[model samples]
Structure formats: C-alpha cells, structure tokens
Target: MTPALSPAEVTINVVGALFAIPIVFGIFIKAPKLVVFGFIGILFCFSDSTWGQLETDANIYSRGVGMFYFSLLNLILMVAGVAALLKRLANPQGPQLAPPMAKYLAAFVFLLLGHVVVGLMQGIELDVILGYSGIFNVLNMMVFMYLVIMAFESEKDTQRLLLMIIALATLRAIFGAVRFFLFDGDTANPYRNFEGLDIKIFYFDINDNFVASLGAFCAAWLLTTPGVKLGWFKRGLLIAFLVLEVAAVALSFRRTSLIGLGLMFLFLFLRLPGTRKFMFSIVAAGLLAAVASVFYEHRLQFASEDDMLSSLIYDIAPSRGIKDGRFYELYAAAQSMDGNWLFGRGTWGTFSGDRERLSYHGDDFSFVHSGFGHVLLKTGIVGLLLFCGLLAAYVGFYMRHRNSLAGYARLLGDAGFAGFLFWVPTLLVGTPIIEFRTMMMLGLVLAMPFIAVGIRNYQVRAYQYDPRYAVA
Candidate 1:
C-alpha cells in the first residue's frame, strides 16, 4: 500500500488542485497566452529526471509521479491545440496556418518516429525505448508551439509573451543568485562535490542556463535595439535585469553558456542594421564592463585558498582538453557508431564494446555528453542530416522574413534569432537534445522567428483592412 499524505501535504495538494482546475479551464477555452506562459514557467521551474536518476529512484513509490503530471499537462495542451486548429480552419479570418518551415520540422518528427520503429526491430524493450526517447518531449514542445501560433490573435499577444518570459526569467535569475550566495550559508566556496566533480547548484536544473541566456539576450535587445522606444524607467529596469541575468549565467559556471553568450553577441552584431550596430556595440561594451567590475569586487571580498574565481577560470581554460572524461566518452560513442552509421543503433541504443569508463551508474551507456554525438549514436547520419536541415530551414526563413518586421516585432525577431544562436554551442557540446527541459526551451526559441513573422503579417493585414489599425 502507498503511504498516506500528511495533513500539510493534503492541504497543499488541495490548494494546487483548486488553482489547476481554473488553469485547465482557461486552456480548454483556447487561451494561448495563458498556455504559453504556463508551459514556459513550468519548464523553468521544474527539473526532469534523467535516465540515470530514474535508476536511483527504484525504491521510491512516487518516483515517476511528477512526470505523470507533466504528461497530463501536455495532454491538456494538445487537446486545446487541436481545438484551436479546428477553430482557425473554420474561420478564414483567423491567424494564418503554420509557416513553410513547419514542413521541415514535420519531416524531422517523422524521422524520430521511424527511429522508434528501428528501436523495436533492434529488440529493445518498450519501456527502455520509451524512457530513452527524449524526442517525445520534443514533439510535445512542438505541439505547444503550434498552439501558440494558432491561439495568439495579434502582435500584442506575442509582445505579452515576450514580456512574460522576461519577467519569469528575471525571477529565476534572482532565485539562482540567492541560492548560490546563501543556500549553504557560505559567503565563499559555494560549490559542493558530487563524487569527484565540483558542481555549483545554482538552481534545481541545468536548464536554468538556457533561461538565463535567453533572458539576457532579450533584455539586451530591448535595451539596445533601435526603434524600440522605451521610457527611461523601463530602460533602467531592463538594464538591471540584464545585469542580473548575466550574473546568473556566470554564477551557474557552465562553460557552454559562456560560449553561447559570445555567439549570441556575434549573431547580433552581424544581423543588426548598420545604423544600429554602433549603438549596440556601445551598450554591449558598457554591459561587459559593468559585469566585470561587479565580479572583480566580489572576487576581492571572497578571495580564499579555494576561491570561486580560480575554479571558474580553471574550468573555462582549455588545459583540461584531453584529460576530460567527456572527451573519452565522445570517443567511445564515436567508435560504437562504426558499423551502424547509416540508420544508427536506434532510440534505445547503447554504446557497444568496452564502455566501462563512459558508463553512468555502472553499465548504462544510453546517454552521452555531446548532443551531436548522441544524435549520431542513435539516429546515424540521416537523422543528423534531418536535424541540421531543420535548423538551416529556420535560419533561412528568419533571414528571408526578418526585414519585413518593424518596431517591437523587429526587436523580438532579432532577440529570438540571437537566442536561438545562443543554443548552438550548447547543442554541440552539452546534452540538451536529450534533456527534456532544455529541448522544451529549444522548441520555444525555435518557434520565436515564426511567431515574430506572424505578428508582423497580422499587423500588416489589419492595417491594410482598416486605417485605424495602423501600427503605432
């Protein structure tokens, strides 16, 4: 029998249900903004269990209960998505259908389903296959994206979505900062060692880095982008939020995030109109100087034998290249893909041969450190091609349509494009593709360009129909 809940737990559950009922009703009513906000908020707030972590929960009765609830949330979103789609189809005046790039994404989803069939033919157990196939969560995110496109009625809806993301992301950054500075009641040496690895647990999940990076880029875009007219007070608040987000990324101590930040700036520099480029450069340099001064002050106060700055510098340095275990793991995964390079070893595939060193939790080799390597290991060159093709399609679509946008739409388009660029380094070096939270965040970023275009087109059409509907 399952254990009974305590009185406090019961009360908490009742309160949660009360709130959830109304939220579900709103979703059923085709509230796109509500659904998008709730979805993104949950992804930022919750952590998903990895396969290795699931192995450790074998003795717990409620081990997978969180995921069960998450599935129900996805189901609700899907039902509402279908309804929204039908409603739009029935009304010719509704928001336009999915953009052209969606077909490429659909093809990628089909390829993932084919991988599942291949997994079954390779004799992998159903449970193992389901557990290892992170692509399912990716599909869920895509559905949510479709719902976003369908349900958002105007450019204001997209603007509000961006605002909600910025607000939530800022809160997350603040929370992470508090945890890093005060969680252990230590002013210095705010890291804990698990086994031999020293990890600074800023938040409950590694995906917080994605949130911080996205928020930082968006804040910077709002603050620096030309034609994005903001009051001095709003600009001041954005500047403060941007600082917090940059600090949060640094405190998280993820090298991939630092690289992603650099790439984002590079993308912004190259994509911005020539007239705005100089302004952006000035703002970017000032922000960097501010962050450096803040960190330098903190380092001075917390300088110790085992200081945080030294550890961060050491981690960022390239001296640990060949000595890193992930390098060996990547090598092992590459060697395992020797014979099955065409279609891959399927979804539930594990690295073959002596992978004792690469194994997590002993004898488990289903997950790898490198996202590209993991894709190659499981789906082979063809799946890799499909994945790359989808990314390329988004880039092409964004470039082709970005010029048509103006004002806030254009600001969001540039920010979204830069945010997506930020993920490139993470996808190549980090295991984001297999991580549910990271993939959901990726889906959101991937949908932004399309959303921006939709907002632009909607406004253009509305203005064409009515003189009063002209964009401000």
Candidate 2:
C-alpha cells in the first residue's frame, strides 16, 4: 500500500495551488469560459485524486472534506463559478436564458433539490450530504453548464471547445501509451494485481480508457462528417491520434471500456449505408481478434477462449450455481426501493446498503457499480425517469437540429450522442453519472443544443438592425 503523504508532497501540492491561482485569475481576465474548459479537461485527464477517494461516502465526513479541499480542479471551479455569477449580477444583460433551455433546466434543478429535500425529511444528515459533497455537486454542475451554454456563442467557439476535448484526449492517450511501454514494470501483463496499484496507475487505467475511446469515436465522426475539410497532414494527424487513443484503451485491459469502444465503432459504422459490407468486416475483425488473442495469449494474459466475445458472454449469462453478478445487483437495487421507490431515498441516500453487502471488497454503498442502479437508488423511479428524460431531451434536440447545425457543432453533438450511447452497455456494470468524468460529459452533452444555435437569433438580428447593438 502507498505510504502517507510525505511533507515534500504536501509542499508540492501547496506550491502547485499557489501557481494555479494566478493562472486561473489570468484566464478569467481573458475569458471566463476558458476556466470552465480547464476544469473539464482536468476532470477528464486528471483522475488520480478523485479515484483514490471515490468509494468514501458522505458518511465519512473527514475524507469527504479532504476530497473537496484537495481537489484543485473543483476548487478552481468553485471560485470561477462564483466570480462568473457575481459578474452576471453586476451586468444583468450578460446571458439571457433560452426558454426551451430554461424549461429543461428548471425540471432538472427541481428534481435535484426535491430529492435533497425528501432525503432530508427521511433523516439523512444535512451536514453529511449537503454542501460540496457528491450529492450537492450537481449544483456546481448546473453553474458550469450555464457557463458553457453562455460562452459557446459562435461556430468558432464550438470548434475550439471540441479541439480542446481532442487535445485533452490526445495528451491522455500519449501518456497512457508511453507509461504502458516504458514506465510500467509489468508491461507484458499490466492488469496483474491491478487493484493494488498506486493511484496514478489506477486512475489512468479507468478514466484514460474512457476519454481515449470516446475521443477516438468523436475524431472518427468528425473525419467522416461532410463539411469537415481536413488537409492531408491534419487528417493523418487525426488518424494517428485515433490509433493512439484506441491502443491506449485496448492496452488498459478494462473489459467495459473495450466493450464501449466496440459499441462506439459499431454505432458509427451503422450510420453508413453498406450494411452487408459492414457485417462482413465485423466478422473478419472478430476472426482476426480471436487469432491474435490465441497468438498473444501467454504474453498478453489473454485468458478467455474466444477473445473478448467469450468474456462478454460470460459476464452477461448467469452462472450455474451463483445468483449474483450485474443481474443480481440490478435486482437487489429494485427490491431495495420498496416504499421510497417513487421519490427515492434522495441523492447519495443509502437506504438499502446494497453496495456494502454486495461489494467484493466491502466498499460502502456509495456506488452500486451500475449507472441505472445508482440513479434508481438515489432518486427512485421518478428521479430515474427525469434523469433519462433530460438525456432524451438532449438526444431529441440534437436529432431535430442536426441537419441545420454548423459543422463543428454537429460533430460535437454526434460525439455527445456516441458518448451517451456508449454508456448503455457499460451502465449495466459501471457507475458513470456519479463519476466526475462522465458527469462532465453529460453536462457537455446537455449544453450541445444551445451551442449549436450560434448566438441567439435575436442577438444576431439586433446587431443587424442597429449599430448600437454592436456598440453595446
């Protein structure tokens, strides 16, 4: 196990924070939105601190406080959000809310706060679950989402944000790939005793795979989009980046991420017209994968017979004797929501303690290892429906305006769609929404519709009709 934090490490952290404070302020001076982007990038690429403390529920008050205080990214966001809010207050004409967006946002906030109230009534400690805890973190997300929508005012702004995402993904992929080959002692078999690895390795293993896979899909989607005009060198660079991202995900040896990558590719391929050709290609790829699995089985620690297919089947299909696995977890979650199945036990409410009882290592009930289960456990059926409705609203909005959306905005929408779809299969055995990376992704997805609209039509019209509009 890793030792306690050394004094040197503490000094390094404090020094880093001191330097970041000025950098963050400077960014605010130029454009406040960049701070939000920086925060999202850090969340996506830097997961070590958060991963170390993911299972520490709100019940653990000391750890919870440490998690928030030590999380430099979250602290930056908190400061930036307050600054942006104050600026908005001083300048009332800063960013007007769109009616359509206001409706959805209202529903989401109402449900979130309503759940908190209900949870409080049920005797969940206010101090434990409220204020900077995982449960209250959605309030921060709402602020970030509002800033994203307000900042993304033009096609260029949208493109820049997508480029930032790609850049973050590229950095993670390069780091993961380099670490796998040169840094990791167990290059040949990295997953061996992986659970006991240090925070950095464990962090890179899970979160890096997500961004790598999702970024690859998004880059591929952009390359395929009609209006995207990538020169030969740029196209080559993107293709190389995609390959690196895919390689990183593959080498992580995380089956869920691998499944997600496969599903993303399948989803992208389905958009094309050549179904028969796609099917043949998939079969050929499967055969090649199986052969490669056998050839590299000893060196790569490939245990399953038919490569990943067998492993996927084994995971989905029930065992002969044991009535456990993801299926059992889902069942238990449903059964546990007996009386409070309507409003739920509230955010971060652990009414059933299913996670503690079912955890392989006695992890507390912070996460059920299932996105749907986590939502169901916290918000019940009603909250679950509202959450899904929020996602569905984004999907529906994207589909409606996909044709008219600017090229970069369309690509972002597509990426968000792919990311959401990738979560479907993984959700069975993964808790995505509660995780900051996926939560940030969800926020970005929710912001897509507004970003796609370019500056509000009224703003455009006002500028066209009156020179004073531009002066203002």
Q: What TM-score would every model get versus the actual structure?
A: 0.79, 0.75
State the lDDT of candidate 1 residue by residue for 169-283, as single tens digits: 8887877677778774212222333232244445434567678878888877776666778999998998889888887766644456666776787777776779889888887
Best by lDDT: 1
Model-by-model lDDT, in order? Answer: 0.65, 0.59
Model 1 / residue 408 / CA error / Å: 1.8
lDDT of 2 by residue, 205-316 (tens): 3556678877888777755655568899989987788767766665555666666777777766665346444553564366337533532442233433545445545545
- Residue 142's lDDT within candidate 2 is 58
For residue 446, what is the lDDT in candidate 2? 64
